[model samples]
Target: MTTSASPSPVLSPEHLARAYSYSAYRQLITTLMAEGKTTGTTQSEALTAYAQLNIQRMERLDKQVQVQPELLAAVQGLQQRYVWLVLTEGWCGDAAQIVPVLEKIAQASQGRITTHYLLRDENLDLMDRYLTNGGRSIPKLIVLRADTLHEVAQWGPRPAAAQELFQAMKAAGATHEEFAEKLHGWYAKDKTHHTQQELLRLINEMS
Candidate 1:
């Protein structure tokens, strides 16, 4: 008989954000990679070995991810302050692709919204709260009213159009490698437009 692990207790958003910010999370990954440490997940060695490469991919995205002028203008008009809290792990491929764009968007908001990151493995309690289809999918974005701590809206791991393509490919029997290659290629061609457009929509609705 196997004993299941207990669930992590939920923690306050402020508490978790204070303990882990986006910059801090990046630093943690950098240090881990420097020391040749494995990824902070319970995944197999093959997946863990890709941590350094994922970090590199994230770095590349940070350098290249751009915010469209229209998206910038829309986010700048946000009259209310919000906190963009993200739950992710460095080893997550989706996160490597998406987090940089989110950071750019938050920065473009020009302090109207601040961004923070919480490691998913370390914050299972919070991750459990925002599960995608009973699974712990990463890059979960939680937008909260800064003053009230009320959740305004949320977005996730990937954009709607991208997710649709992914589901369709999977349904059509695309293997994991093929799916990853195609999805990333799509993102490359997309140049963050889908993510930005969707974010604009979310902002418009929340505002």
Candidate 2:
């Protein structure tokens, strides 16, 4: 089992905008990471802390989001069993930002939340189980139950449409080199947004 450093989750979203936010969130994430690296906090301990923090967030959000149908249903489902697995690189903005929201959701779902932070470079074997356009993308959030893998939910880097640009480069007689350059930049720039969108796809597909 993986261990994370924290009294609660130091969600990935902080990593994305850590340098940008004035909130204490960034410091929390850094501290969590440091603790995990140094103190060897077990997975369950980290997850329990993550759950405790999100429980408060959900308690607050409940007042406002009580009417959301999907949210309510997700909350109900979580009341049963919830396991959250996140695939991310520290450099990913989406993971740093969105994972906190997930923590909150798990809380609302009724105290059933567990978070596993897997560094993408360190976890190729796991990523191979998930495929998109012949590639594996980051921040794939998977929820499971018991020892059985009943995937109620999952998410990943979004598939963006570069078809227009791909075609434009083709028509312009641009080499594959030009196309690759533009495509790479696009993915890098909109990485977070893509993760959110891809997350929707994974959930929909799995559901």
What TM-score, over all chains together, does every model reach? 0.86, 0.45
User: Which residue segments of model 1 deviate by more than 4 Å?
Assistant: 1-14
Could you list the CA RMSD of all candidates, in the order they appear? Answer: 6.3, 12.8
Estimate, for each residue in 1-207, the C-alpha lDDT of model 2 and write its tens digit: 112222332233342232222123334445554554211223455443543443343334334332234544645554355466666543343344445455545555555555555555555656675665467655566556524435555554424354455557878999755765775566446533543344334333433
Supply candidate 1's per-residue lDDT for 135.
87
- What lDDT does the true structure give each of the candidates? 0.78, 0.47
Question: Could you give candidate 1's per-residue lDDT for residues 131-174 as a string of tens digits?
Answer: 88688988888887777656767888799888888889979999
User: Candidate 2's C-alpha lDDT?
Assistant: 0.47
